[model samples]
Target chain A: MKLRLRGVRKSFGSKVVLDGIDLDVGEGAVVCLIGSSGSGKSTLLRCINLLEPLDDGVIELDGLDIAEPGLPPDPIRRRIGMVFQSFNLFPHLSVLDNVALAPRKVLGVPTAVARVEALELLARFGLADKAGDFPDRCSGGQQQRVAIARALAMQPELLLLDEITSALDPELVGEVLDVVRDLRQSGMTMILATHEMAFAREISDRVCFLDAGRILESGPPQQLFGAPQHDRTKAFLLRVIDAGRLER
Target chain B: MQQEPTRRQRWERRQRRRSIAVAALSSTTALVAVVLAVPRLPGYRKVRAAFFDGEIFVDTFGPLARAFLYDLQIFAWCAPAILMSGMAIALARTARSPALFPLRVAATVYTDGVRGVPVVLWIYLIGFGVPGLLQSRTWSNPVLWGSTALIVAYSAYVAEVFRAGIESVHESQRAAARSLGLSNTQTLRHVVLPQAVRRVIPPLMNDLVSLQKDVALVSFLGPVEALRRAQSFKSSLANFTPYVGAALLFLCVSVPLTRLTDHLLQRERRRMSATAIR
Candidate 1:
């Protein structure tokens, strides 16, 4: 499914978070959104999933009007699954149950069928052994992978990953990225808001640099990373690369 | 590492054993003293007359049996009524509806106001005052009036307990349930309430225990329950032994329940801790 956002504007009281934002992800394309903190990258991703109500905008998902205020949004939301930064898996539920919940409750799948599908997804994410375990018992990377598997259990057409690896430890980040890389190889349409520049360049077909609640530049990985046209993009790339080195 | 036991450590261990032994000896001695004293106490003659003399005890057994049957009947009828009414009021208030605000306020006021006063006052009001004010002598049936009073008072307290239980669930659980496409009611029934009820089991069991004790208070209305029977035996036999007998009867019913509640609460705490570790 193709997701297109147009003239999106969201504000919290007086502070403008998303100001006249616009972006799009073509069918089966991996679009990476990169920006520093407080740049509204996460808010933009939340708008796509309708987790945050948009103040003003049109978000079209697979030709369906999700941004229309009165429209029933569950049908659209069901087709678009989201993975949050915190890996918001239900702590009270087992790994298999967390993945099975949406399918059984929302999609009305039978319990046995949902469990089978959930186990298969967990196996794919290398979490089959942890199926009976709760999220808190798992490592950060394992939890994030289970979260991704949970989203996939909904059989969504488009996956919205909002800094999924940002909350992981340095050593744990690679395992979660591997899952995303596997998803990329499987031709899943994903819009990833992330700080992992190299991963974005490695996996994303296009990279969109956002600054101050707007897209400053967007293009193929080679042009954006190697020969960026915008000065803001260059500055951001330099700062990020410098910060990355300092962390190491 | 061969180390001599410190004097304080050895003394502490000895003290612990001494206290346990003292407690056991004192309890047994107290039990024997009570048994010996019972025959010489002021009411022993009358207690013997009631139990062995077969005068008041046999004559009152019929009424006592009838009262016991009536008590069971009242519990059967009133428990569900109180539980349903209390649960409905609690769930409705927590439903977050504007219309239920008045009901919630009324329920709160009722619980607080009624519980603040002695239950004896409520019994008198329901049993005597209401009938006098309504000018209906038929409302003089002590059984009906007394049960009414019990239900009203117990319902208030139970509603508060239920409300606290419902609120004990974390807000995130509700959000998660909603995100799963369950409606508000479905979320409550499937997700929120089950967890909340589990959390409140200990308190709810305590309420049940207190409620059972409160049943004895209904004897004041004069239908001759265990307490009333004992009271009458005391007056006729002129002694306190019947009170002791009634107390023993109450302990027989309540002690096992208290232990069961404690056991269940302990198990629940262990389960919660294990889940939290996960």
Candidate 2:
């Protein structure tokens, strides 16, 4: 397994955001977390990246317990790159510099070397022409792609995507999903929190249904999406189907 | 095809011109009234001879202008120190580590203590008290101690301005930087400070304007700067025109700074409104 979470628990004040989240991701596996809004999907991704301190339990990466006290999170975060739903690219930097920043600053790469790598990544994402343009100049879809490229520049072992498509317009969604599809084909391990049921069913190797901060069900995407055993999962999928989000 | 103005548009244009005419007439009348009334007051000639003596202004302008260079010299050194120490203090105050609690407290106390005391009193205390306590000739240089006083007092104000700018940055920016494995210092240096500093440039320019003017206050320590030179002429020559000359010299620098601050503020506002559309 590349990543493991055993009994991960997190709370904000009196509200429990992630209650006993236990999961595993094998090498190059793509796991999709499907849930309604406020089902702890985002918080789970944040905790996994160590953005938020967990209230309880352990998260292991490559068999090493990273949840131990006094463990500096920077190294762990470098290994686990995350793309946020809001596409938080640094607005002050150009798309190229946004991608190059972590490599140059955190990884100690030379400026020219980082720029070369960043330009290559931008070209791969169809953003080579936008290398000099700031994030505000790019469309939402382009910004999100640049954000993904930025996360990938660190060459992370595992990538956590927190509802990466949730903020995108319908017409722009496919481009971003295409990027995810390419990453999967390139054998990058990923955990995605997504609202796009069709994309999750198409791309996910394994699907987990979360409700009220717990994993309600988990299995192959077909088994879980087509034949949900739990009532909550079935009800959630039914609402999604009724909303025309999932093509039944 | 350019269309002619509509009736309502022409009427509004005429109204605007009339309002501008009225404004000009009223302001001119007020100015003429003040100008005509002031000279008619009893003993106006004596007051004018003492304060507006053209001969005294011509005689002292050269010396006072040269002395103004001392103020500029003090400002030149103090400005950089103020910026660096102010930023350090702001960072110290914002640090969240349990271990840095004392540092945070000290920063708070330093800002509060320095800001609470009047800048003039600080000049007196640091300039005179420090040298008196040390009893060293090197330390007794009024220019050195006076410059230190300005730096100490002004840095406190500048630090508060910096802290406000830093706090204005959204927490999500910090979160995004941290998620990329940037350490706290790296996030601050790369992500936070750049945005914060850009946002606060207008306000910082305002502070620099104030600092430029206040540099003359160091004349209290008896460095023969512009204000001191003006004071000496006032006492020895029994005339105040050198003070007026000094005021004009100070305004020469400060007015430009004020105009630059306004230009930056307008540009910043325009940038904000443009981005807000996104």
Candidate 3:
């Protein structure tokens, strides 16, 4: 499904986090949103899923205006799955249960059917063995993979990855990125809010550079990363490269 | 590197020390107090005989046994009612609505006030004051009044317990449920409450144990159950033997429940630790 955001604005009290932002996510395309901390990258992704209410904006998913007043957002949200930074797996539930929860509870699927689907998704993420275990029993990478699997279990047409690797240990980050890379190869459309520029550049069909709640520049990854059109994008890229080198 | 002591080993050492200290202190104190109080024992016996005796034991114990049976009957009947109402109220309040403010206030007042007041007073108020106002002479069954008071008081406390349990679940869990398209009520019933209730099992068991012991407080109005039987037996024999016997009966009933509570708590702790390790 195509996602279009026009003139989206959101603020918490007096702090304007997202200011008159516009972007479009084409069908089956992986779009990476890059920005510094508190630049509203996460907030914009949250707005797309309607997790955060937009103060003013038109969020259209497949021609349906999700942000239209008095319209129910549930149908829009069901098609848009979100993976949080914390890999928000339900600690009390088993891996299988976490993945199966949305399907069984929301879609009214039978337990057996949900389990079968959950196991298939887990198998894809190589977490089938961990299905009976609680989320706390899994590594950060495994948990994030399960989170991805959980989103996939909803059969979501659009997936939102909100800095999924940000909370992982350095060694664990690659495993989670690999899962997303696999999802890309499988043709699952995704919007990724990330600091992993290399992975973003590698996997993203389009890259949008956001700064201070506005899109600085957006285009194909090669054009945006290798031959930037904005000086701000170049400065941001230099800072990220320096930070990445320091981490290494 | 040396391995740390297992939890069981640590618990065992702590238990040993506590039991030894309790035993030594209680034995010494009991011996000294008994020696000093022996001279006054005869005076106490004389006073006790005046107010209580064998016939009183017969009069109270017999009827108390009957009343206890009645109390149990009432508990069985009202347990489902209390649980259903308490759960419904708790869910309604947590899910948030215009009614939440008043419901929460009422719940807070009911639990805190009723729990703080002596159950006997509540029994008196419900049985004597309210019924008297209604001009219902048949409301004199202390057993019914006592059970009603217990249910009302305990339900409030349990409802709060359930509310806390529901709230203890992380907000993320609710968000995940909502993202899946489950309505607020469905999220509560399917996602939030199940996990919350599981976390609260040990505390719920503790509450049940407290409820069992509190059943004895209902003995104030008349000999309704075991307490009355023991009191009557003491009066008949003009000795403390029956009271001692009744105390043993209470211990018999409550001891297993206390042990069950401990067992459940230990199990929960283990489950938590296992989860934490992951």
The residue-by-residue lDDT of candidate 1 on A34-99, one tens digit each, is 888888898888777776789998898777779999676566677877887888777657889889
Q: List model 1 lDDT by residue over B62-157, tens digit each.
A: 555555555556666777777777787678667686777887787777778878988778888887766677776766787787878888888777
Q: How close is candidate 3 to the true structure, as a TM-score?
A: 0.83
Q: Which stretches of candidate 2 lie over 4 Å from their true place?
A: B1-51, B261-278
**Each candidate's interface RMSD, rounded to one decimal?**
3.1, 2.2, 1.8
Could you arrange the candidates by TM-score from highest to lowest?
2, 3, 1
Residue pairs of candidate 3 with colliding backbone atoms: A136-B278, B53-B235, B53-B236, B54-B235, B54-B236, B57-B232, B61-B229, B64-B223, B64-B224, B68-B224
DockQ, per model, reads 0.23, 0.49, 0.56
Candidate 2, what DockQ? 0.49
How much is A201 displaced in model 2, in angstroms? 1.5
Model 3: docking quality category: medium
Worst 10 residues of 2 chain B by lDDT: B269-278
Task: Output the better candidate (2/3) by lDDT.
Answer: 2
Please report the TM-score between candidate 2 and the true structure. 0.90
Error at A58, model 1, angstroms: 2.0
